[model samples]
Target: SRPPSEEGHSVDELCPNVRIHEGVNVSNIMEVPFVVSIQRRISPNLFAHFCGGALIRPHWVISAKHCFQQQRSIDSYRIVGGTIDSEDTKAESSEIADILYPDEQSGSHDIALLRLKSPLTIAQREDFQQLKLASDVAANKYHSCHCFAAGWGVDSLDSGQPMRYLKRARLSMKFPKKCYEEHLYHTGNFPLYEDPSLYHCFERGEGEDRGVTMEGDSGSPVYCHVTDGTGRVDAVLYGPVSFGYYPEDANGVTIMADKMTYTSNPQIHADWIRKNMKQ
Candidate 1:
C-alpha cells in the first residue's frame, strides 16, 4: 500500500520500504567490506529490494530481526556484499538459507542471524571480510573514538526510493539513560530501558551537519573503532539499527528524522549471539 502521495498500489507489491540520512556516498569496496545489502526478489519482472546487513562470517550475516517482519520466504532474499553497488552483477551475492530469531515474538531480542545457503566466495578478493562482533568491554574501549554505519538507504526525507549508491555516516554514541529519556520507547513487553542488553546509538553532530537512520537502514551495523589484541586499530560491530523517530512538518508530512538510540545491544547478548553465530 502506497502513501497518499502515491497514485495507486498493486496486490503483490514488489517494492521495499527502507537508509542512512545525511550520509556520504561510497564507491571503493575495500573501505567497507563488512557492509552488506539485503534484497528481496518479488516476481519475475519485479525489482529486487535493497535492505541493509553486515557480513559477520563466511556463511552468516547479522541483521535486525524486525527486518524479516515482512516474513518473505528465506529464499527470496539475496545477500549482496563486496561492492556497494546493487546492480553490479560482478559483486558477491549469496543465498539466504534461513533466518534465526532468538525470540519469535520479537520482544526485547531484535537481532537475528542470516544463515547463508552457501559460504561466501572470499578467495583472493580482499573486498569481502568478516566483521568482528564487539563485547561490552570492547564497546567501552572505543567510547570516544570515531564510529561509523553504512547502507543503501533512502536518498531524502521525501521519498521511499533507495539511494542505490552505498552510503556511510559517522555517528556519536548516546548514553543508555539519556537515550531512554529522549525516546521514551521503553514500554510493555518491549521496555528498552529495563533490559541493559538492548541499547541505542544516534548521530549527534551539531548545527546543519546532523544525520539519522531512515526507513531502509534497518539491520545495518554500528561500527566502533577498537584496538585489537596486537594494538592495531580495528573496526567491530556494535549493534544493529533497530528503530528511530520520524518528525513531521507543519503540513503533517515527515521532515528530517531523528532519535536512533534503539538497537539490538550486541554487548548484552554476546552469549546468545555467539552460540547462534554459525547455526
Candidate 2:
C-alpha cells in the first residue's frame, strides 16, 4: 500500500489500483560508469541509500541541491561507485568532504557538487567513468537528442523501497512550450524556476519496456549520447533529476504521466560547476 497523502486521503482512496514492479536493471556496471549512490549514515556501521549522483571528476560529484537540504553535515553522507548494485559490498566508497552550491542570489538551480574526502582512482578502471557537462549548444538541441536516465531509486511508487541494483530508462525530450503547458495544467502551478531554459523536460518513451524514476531517485544523472571530437560514441551530462509530477487517474490511482520528469539544466550552471570543481 502507498503512504497517505498530506491531504488526509487514505492510501486506498488515493491509489486504489496502485501497481508495483521492479525497474529494468542495468546488466553491466560499465554501462553507467558515472552513476553513484548517495547514502546517509543510519548507524555506526550501516548506511542507507538516499539519493543519486554522477561522478564529474575524480574527486567531484554532481547532484541535486534538495538532497542535502535537510542534512548539511558533510560527515553524514558518503558515495558509492564502481558498481551497479547498490548493495554490492565490494563497491568503492568515499566520505563526502564538502558540498558546494551556486549563489542563490543569481538564480535557483537544483544542482550541487560534492567534493570527496579523497580522489577515486578513475584511470584504468573499467567500472569508473567521469562525465563531462554538456555545452550550451548541445543542451539547446536536446529536443532532437537521444537521452536516458539511470539511478537506484525505488522501482515503483507504492513500494517506497530503493532498488538493490541500478536501472536505466529511455526518455524523450519534450518541447519547452508543451512541457510547461502540460505541467501547469496537471499540477496547477508553474515550474520551480520561471525560466524554462533552466531545466530540461523529458517523458518516458512509449511501450511496456519504458521506466520512470520514483522515490529516492533525485540527483540521478540524465545523459545524452553524442559523438565526441574523435568520432567515438560518448555521452555528456545534461542535468540531474530535480522533480516529477504524478497525476491521479479516473480511479484516483496515481499514474506516472508523460512530460513529468524535470531535470536541472547543467548548462545554466556549467560556469559555476567548473569554477567550484577547480577549488
Candidate 3:
C-alpha cells in the first residue's frame, strides 16, 4: 500500500517515495541480469505489491522466505522476469509451483526458493545475462564492488506510495564478519544482526548520499557489479531494512541478506527446486 500525505500529492510524487526522474543512472541499470519482480494480486481486491527476486536456474527463483510466509496459496504469487521497468515492463511471468522456506526461522539463514512451473526465455539484449552464485566471498577480497538494487520502494522512508519508474542505486560489498560486528550480534538468533549465511551487506557513498531500501523492496535482488567474472549475484534475499534500526528514521539504511551463512543452505533449496519443479 502507498503512504498517505497531508498535501494530497500522489504517492510517487512525495519525498522518499519520489519518482526516479529521467537521467538517473539508466546506463548501469541495463547491465544487471537475473533481476525479478515479485507480484501478487489477491482476488476481489486488485491491489498489488512488488518485491525483488533473482533467477538462479531457469525455473528456480531465490528470494526471501518471509516474502511468502504470509501467502496462503501459491496461486497468488507471480514471478516477473526480465525487466526493471517500474510502470510497464513485459516479463516472462510464471506461476509458483511451490515456495521453500526454513522451518527454524533464522534471519541469518533466511532464504526461499520459488519453483516456477516453467523455465524462462532469454531476451536478446547483450546487457541481459544470467547471474552466478558464489559459494564464498572472501573477506580479504572486499573489492569495493559496485552493485545495485531495483524496486518500486519508496525514495525516502517517510512518504509512501510506490514509485512509478523502477529505481536503482550503487552499493559496495561488506564482509560478513564486519557486518556482524557493525550490527552488534555475537551469535544466537539476533534479529538486529543479520545472519551471515544467507545475506551480504552493502552501503552507499559515505552514508551521506545514501541509497535507501524501503517497503516493497523486500525479496528484491541486490546484484553485484556487472564487470565481475561470473557476474554472480549476492543471493540470500532481504535482510535488515531501515526499520531494523529505527522506525522514525525511515529509509535510515538496510543490511542485505547473507547467502553463505545458511539458516537453510541454498544448495538444499536448489535441490528441492530441481526435484519439485519437474514434478
Candidate 4:
C-alpha cells in the first residue's frame, strides 16, 4: 500500500490539491500517442507509476523536473508508452539512459528530458508518435484555444489512488495574468513565483465540461490545436502540468472554486531543448 499524506489522505491523493475532475477515460491508445508513463523501479521486476510524460523523440521524453526531487540512480527510472493503461505490464518500456535539465535555472521552469537507453521504433508503431513543441507564435496564441491533457492522475480526494487506465480532459486556457490575479485574490498571496510569463494557466469548464490536473499528473503534456493560414490543423505541445493553487477559506480549509492549474512554458526553453538534444 502507498503511504499517506500529512492530511491522512494517500500520498497520491492530492499533491498540490488538483485533479482531472469529470475527465473521460481514453478509449484508444492512438488518441494519445505521445503520452508515456514515467515509472520508478521498486524492485527487480516491479515498477510503480511516478508521473506522466510526453515522447518528443523516439529516444527522448519530456517531464517535470520536480518529479525527480530526491536524488536517485538514473537506472531506477523508465518510460512506458503505447498503451492507455498505465499498469499494463505488457506495454513497451525503455530504460532511461540519461536526464537533462536547462543550463540556466530560473527556479521557475519545471521541465526536464529523459533519454532512453534505446530508441523505440516509433515510426513503425501505429500507437506511438512524437509530439512537436509549440512554436513561439502558437504558444503566444494559446490563451484563445481549447486544449486537451491526459494522464493517469487521481480523479478525486475520495479516491486516493491514480486511475488504472488513462483519462483525458478538455481544458480552456487562461491568461497567466488573470491566473495570478485570481490566485492572489483568493489565497491572499502569490504563487511560488510572481512572474506570470513563466507559467501557463488553465481552468476547468462548467457542468459537463469540467476537468483539472491532479496529483501524479506532474509532467503530463497539455496540447492545443493550431490552424495555420493554409487551414491545416496541428496539435502542438504547450507545456507540462507543473503546479496549481488551492485557495483556502477563512478557516484555512481548501475551497474548490477557482481550481487553476499551471504548466511551465516549453517555448521559453525551446532553444535549450534543441541545444541539449544534440548533446
Evaluated at residue 20, the lDDT of candidate 1 is: 23
- In order, what is each prediction's RMSD in angstroms? 12.1, 10.8, 11.6, 10.4
Least accurate 10 contiguous residues by lDDT in model 3: 240-249
Q: Compared with the true structure, what per-residue lDDT tens digits does model 4 show for residues 1-104?
A: 44443445542232222232454778877777888899888999898887999888788888998998879898888899888988897888999988887754
Instruction: Give each model a TM-score.
Output: 0.77, 0.82, 0.63, 0.81
By TM-score, the better pick of 2 and 3 is: 2
Give the alpha-carbon lDDT of every model: 0.66, 0.75, 0.52, 0.75
Worst 10 residues of 2 by lDDT: 14-23
Task: Point out where model 2 deviates above 4 Å.
Answer: 1-23, 123-129, 136-144, 207-209, 228-231, 257-259
Q: How many clashes in each candidate?
A: 6, 0, 21, 2
Model 2 lDDT, full chain set: 0.75
Arrange candidates by TM-score, descending.
2, 4, 1, 3
**How many backbone collisions does model 2 have?**
0
lDDT winner between candidates 1 and 2: 2
User: In model 1, which residue pairs have backbone atoms overlapping below 3 Å?
Assistant: 18-215, 18-216, 19-153, 19-216, 19-217, 200-261
The regions of model 1 sitting more than 4 angstroms off are 1-23, 45-47, 104-107, 123-129, 136-144, 185-193, 206-210, 228-231, 247-261
- Tens digits of per-residue lDDT for model 1, 164-213: 77777766777766776555543424545454446665754432324566
